[model samples]
Target: METFLGVDYATLWFLVIGGLFTGYAILDGFDLGAGAWHLFLNTEKDRRIALNAIGPVWDGNEVWLVIAGGALFAGFPVVYATVFSAMYVPFMLFLTSLIFRAISIEFRSKEPMRWWRQSWDVAYSLSSVLLALLLGIVLGNVLQGMPIGENFEYVGNWLEFLNPYAFMVGVCTLGLFMMHGAIYLIMKTEGRLFLHLSALVQKAIIFFIVSFVITSVYTLIYFPHLSDRFKESPALFAVPLAAFLSIANIPRLITKKKYGLSFVFSSITVSMLLIMVAIELYPAIIMSTFDAAYTITVHNGSASEKTLGIMLLMAAIGAPLVAFYTGFVYKTFRGKVQMDENSY
Candidate 1:
């Protein structure tokens, strides 16, 4: 195994993959959250503004997912193959929702008829919510542990993926996204829409808090192992503490009409929570419910040292370019969305 800065190449790639997915969650999460709020807006104009708020950057945000997938394939092909094969149904549904989401955005504006627009609006919102839930559900199953038999093959029934813990996690994820999206919408609108979102953000904050509390309690009671790392290493507690503070601060910022900061904290909340998950499953990417031996860790699942090293070099060169491009796009489209001819 190649060593870089006291960490092995596989560990480095694990961090890289985690960072990529975290970026995706922070970037794409807001838009999906925004879309989840679609049907809640009263009028067509409000819906249009909501849609256009994410118009410029939604597709670009998805690029992180594509990159994350590629990185998974490159860095840990075994884990990728095993998990994807195991969760094929969920992933397929996720991909289908992504397609419908894109199509809804593009097709919604093509026809001026009310029925056409409404149909796409429903599709857009439903797809957005479904996507967020599915992501959480998948993560939940990963954390709760999958039933992998010999050769890393899934041994459980397909429907087993929808167990209580996974469903709860999915709900929590939806709540978080909704809160995050409301804050983004608040930052990007003015007048009536802003006021509406302002009121709605309060509800979103409560939704997230309730869901978060329930999920945390459930995890501690049912899955004590997830917290063993933090208990063993007191310093790692900082991540969860930071996550809590970040979440706690959201309501305060929202009350002060400091939406920009609220959005920042929302992003922080997402990052901190994911970081906590990474901390919980440091070496293990996926746990095996059936047997400990089948659990996939960075060491057992990574690519060759040379392959990882070369890929790390390429990632070093490419990641910055993608970050820069993402930043440029956001900077270019900053501020309140204006309904022009090109707007979604």
Candidate 2:
């Protein structure tokens, strides 16, 4: 119950964990997005350029994910234990996709055979799309509720994670990442390639808008509880409003050939949407579908206050170092990708 600036340590840890994952989602989301475009880009040179575009920084971007996962495990061991144990299949699929994604990037250019490159191309694109989908499904499932019982055990069937709502959320996540990736690709190409990617950016814009709108409508109609908080407290509505504006700005920026600015908004859109999710499910890490009494609140799911405090102190010292290095890598490799013999 220790307070930091009037917020309890638990709540602060929740914010820290959320912020770290948000950073992961934004950084890795583009990598996945760029991979999603691999097959659609036409020609091996285009794909290689796309690969090298992210090459210098893609693996480094994953460090945020590792840190985020570790932070969650440290700050909320109960939530971490239950989620990883119960949602075994989805997490495994996620891990598999992550590995395949890395493999596709590394192995795609190792040979001169068309079949070999095409094989890795398919692996890269499919894995990226699947990874995005799995992330969405897990989040959707979490947003809906868990089937935890007394003693904080997962009592329901693991296959229940495949419900309709989760699939819809998964699709939305894919579309959003695709759009985000298209915008990044624009920044990494020129001339004909840029025009081709411009067309893709347009298509991705429409795709995400349609997916986002459809998912929003479905949630509003069938998932009332998720929106109840914003409805009751009108101020919380700004999050969604900002999300709308961010999504809207991407197209305008693209039209103006301002892809750098567009990518910034793409990052913001992901952040705002996740922040809204955090707002909708505050205090409660996982709501129990079977009984409200069985729900896992931050207090129930977290570690000892001392453990959280120590981990938080570590994050405070460590986050900036990670961010600084990440920014440095990206800055060093910024601008259009110039592929050479050493390129991916």
Candidate 3:
């Protein structure tokens, strides 16, 4: 129970792990979103523009996922073991989508045949959509709570994950990513494609807003505990307030033709939403459906103090390097995408 300025090592590591996953969601989210939009573009050039828009950064963006997974394993091995064991089916599907996403990007242009390109397009779009939905579904189930029995093992069958709330959350997540991806694409294209994306951006905003409102209403009705923190401490209300404003800013920015700002707002929207989730679940990383005593909190789920301290030191070095690298990549690739011989 080593304390850093009154906060225990476990809490500190919880913040670190949360930061990593939030980074993953914001970074890789748009790329996945972009991939999900592949089939919507009309022409070969438009499709290529969509593909190459994310080309320079998709792989690098995905590095965040790897880091997040490793950080989860390192910081909360028990949580990882329990959750992953329960989520093997969805996890496998997620992995499969990721593989197809990568291959779709790589193999799309390797041949000139119409059927080959079309097949890969379907693979790419479907996988990207599936990946986003699956991520959401997993998050939804995790939030709803797990049935842990005997030595912290998940006792429920996989079908239990297909509950209505989880599926609604999945749809909401897909809508959010689609909106996010469309905004990113707007920042990287112009003329006819921009017009196409411009039209799509407005629609995406509506789609996301509708999904978010429904989900929020559902949570308020069925999951009242999530809002307890904000109700108990009015100051913590700023997280949701900030999230609401960020979400509101997107459509406004888009109307003003400020796509870069719109994209920034989209990223902020994602980060703020996740922050709200962290606030809601603070301490309890996973809640037990069967009984309150079985809840897994930051205090109960962290690694050894020595292990955490050493890992924190390593993370101190590594996290900034990753941030700097991510920033440099975005900076170098700034502005609208233009295809070249090396483009995806």
Candidate 4:
């Protein structure tokens, strides 16, 4: 057994970051996906149902983002600084979108005007789209490698990060989340809205699968470095393979009216994608476009053993508490969502 202090710092950091990502994907994923159903819901009643489907859970779901960022800052300061500084603009945009999303949800109930409600809905949905795309672009940049100088700082300009590969990844991420939200809507609501969400989910899944394949091939070809990793460790493919299988089962699960199962599979797909990226970037918390040796490793990026030990202890306690609270909220809000005429 590895002692907490003796464990590879890089591995531990990876585990922390990975856990946060997985939790976020499973929790925020449905809420984001629920936003996708916003477009399909025509009636005011149906829209309210869509909103309430995620209302109880969306705010709580965002806690994972905080956890993920906190883990990065504490466990992998180098990575946190490098990625955030290099991707500052996009990160800001992403953050702004999240802010709008929160504000929209909060103020949505304060007004009964049609325009006010509609504006909030647009803000919520648009924010979802931007957040999804930003996440994808960040992943794409990581997989493709960043331009880090001798001092381990990002040397590339903002525009340099906006390549075709990154753009495709953004699209893929957006489509996947939309599909995820659709599945959640199907599971959480009933009536015409539920059926409409189901159909939308199916379509979104089809788009996601097709785009994912194309982007995968493009990523492999353009980023031969990533392909080399796969060649050295063929097991890495298992992540995507698992994702593919889960995605394939989504429709079947939905057809049987297994909404929870369908959402589970969709969440699995996102989790597998995160695992795949983490695997591809192993040992290098921040890769350098100039030279692999310039890349930041776990050992180099980590805090002191004392700091990590303290973090581990806190995580052991806090992580479970967060999980318990999250689970409690979800359980408390389970079952079909109904929206009254005056509902927020």
Candidate 5:
């Protein structure tokens, strides 16, 4: 018999994972979109507007990532340890890039020299690209399964990590985020910059559409086990179909010049894709290539019932507060970014 505590634990895990990704899409989406359009911003004023568009909210956006990580650590320590231990190098690189990007955003303004500012801007853009790619690769690796021994430890060498399927997944992830970022910038900025950013988004959307199609086909053909899962779980197909439909809606949204709608559609595309991936990997938190029995699932990988219960209680109180604070921040700062000498 299931207790209320067990149900609560399950519900809280779903909420935290879903909420973090949603928050990430809504918050980091604009920043990434702004960075994607950075090269097109020819004037300092344009660049500053791009920068300020994300200024007040970027710090807050990072909180979701922290929460996600903390939830993973506390609720699923085994998965956390295995993932981090296996992918230590990539994780370090990801963290380093994020740190530099965050610091550079603040420090760039303080530098009076053109070269210094330009250097930081480049760092910001590159870091964003790397971070997105790393996330993609990580997702790809999870989906494709890793070499896990009987002891539930990773057995594959670092070099063998970049398989063809994983690479394709990485490409898909990178392209999707780039497109997601572009849509975000189109919604947030105005004037010639907005027009230019819109064009960039259109191009990116096309690229991602092609990549998505190719990746979908590849996954179907090469990953027969996953394809079998899709066949077995007919209901799960809705997620990817929704993602595809969202992709299709982008052109119409763009044609109408409905930037906000375009952004929404782009976000839907991402959210649906994530949902599809999660569905595909259901019950298996971490799949094992070396040993089938070694696969980690929510039942086996999750924390103790008592700990999960307490975490659920804390999340119940905290999640609403997070939502309210995020909404307030966005509402308070709602407007086109204006460039000023003091802008940072």
Candidate 6:
């Protein structure tokens, strides 16, 4: 068992994979959130402005998702295999939504016809909403435990993935992304559209807060195991505390007309919530409903130490470059979106 900074390679790889997905969630989250708001912009020009707000960065943001997937496959093949196998329908639907989203964004502005634009707008918004829900449902199922029987194999039916708890998480995820998207929109638009989004963002904030409260109550009541870690170590409660404070600060920032700071807090809220999930499920990647002994954990599910070490070295070299590139793109595109001929 190789160790880096007193942590095993498996644990390190787990953290790496988690970090990659967290990046994806934060970066692409607003894109999905913005798309989720597509149908609500009220006019063609409003829609176009919203669309172009994310134009330069959406595809680049998706790069994080791609990297995260690759990291998952490399670092935890068993969990990857089992999860993909178990949630085949959801993942396929997710991929379909992703395709529709991309095509909707590209195709919406390709024509001037009212019918054509309207059709694509619906597709874009629906796909974005579905994508957010599916991501949450998948995560909810993972948190609740899967029906892994043996050999780290998932023996559950696809329909089982849509249980009540998962749906609540899905709704919660959608609300969070919508709020995040609204804040981003407020930051990027001005005049009538900015005012519209400013009002809409308040509703989004309320939506997310309500959904979060319901989901938290459900998890604490039905999935008590999630809170076990916090109970065992009282200080670990700070993650959720931070999550609460961050969520609280977003509305505060928005009210103060500090949308740029609001966006920062929104990103922090996403990161903190994911961190709490990581804390709740440390060591175990996927819990087994059939039997606790059959759970897939970092130690049992990870690639060989040598493989993880090599990949860790690769991530170390590549991560900084990716971060730099992402920063460069955001920096280049920073400030209010102005529409021109090149705008989407």
TM-score of each: 0.99, 0.98, 0.98, 0.95, 0.94, 0.99
Off by over 4 Å in 2: none
lDDT string, candidate 2, 242-293, tens digits:
9999988888988888889999999999999999999989879999888899
Better of 3 and 6 by lDDT: 6
The alpha-carbon lDDT assigned to residue 245 of candidate 2 equals 94
lDDT of each: 0.94, 0.90, 0.89, 0.82, 0.78, 0.94
Show pairs that collide, candidate 6.
Answer: none
lDDT of 3 by residue, 1-344 (tens): 69888988888898998898888888888988888888999788899989988888899988989988998899998899989998899999999999999999999999989899999999999999999999999999877788987667888998788888888899888888999999999889989899998998788889889999999899899999888888889999999999999998899999999888898999999999999988888878888887778878887777899999999899999999999999999899898888788875
RMSDs, each prediction? 0.7, 0.9, 0.9, 2.0, 1.9, 0.6
Residue 156, model 3, lDDT: 92
Compared with the true structure, what per-residue lDDT tens digits does model 1 show for residues 1-344?
56999999999999999999999999999999999999999899899999888988999999999999999999999899988988889999999999999999999999999999999999999999999999999999999999988888889987888899999999999999999999999989999999999999999999999999999999999999999999999999999999999999999998888999999999999999999999999799999999999998888888999999999999999999999999999999999988888876
Residues 1-344 of candidate 5: C-alpha lDDT, one tens digit per residue = 22474554654575567667767755676576567557667877777777888888888988888888888898888888988888887899989988987987899899788898888888888887777777777888888888877667888887665677777777777777777777766666788988878778778878788878888888888776775667897886787778778889988888899877887888788788877777777678789988899998777778887888788778889989988999999899877777777797
Candidate 6 residues 1-344, lDDT tens each? Answer: 89999999999898888899999999889999999999888988999999999999999999999999999999899989999999999999999999999999999888989999999999999999999999999999999999999798888776999899999999999999999999999989999999999899999999999999999999999999998999999999899999999999998999999999999999999999999999999879899999999999999998999999999999999999999999999999999999899987
Arrange candidates by lDDT, descending: 1, 6, 2, 3, 4, 5
Cα error, candidate 4, residue 114 (Å): 1.3
lDDT of 3 at 275: 91
* Candidate 5 weakest ten by summed lDDT: 1-10
lDDT, candidate 3, at 334: 90
For model 5, the superposed segments whose C-alpha errors exceed 4 Å read 1-15
Model 6, position 81, has a per-residue lDDT of: 94
User: Which window of ten consecutive residues has the lowest lDDT sum in model 3?
Assistant: 143-152
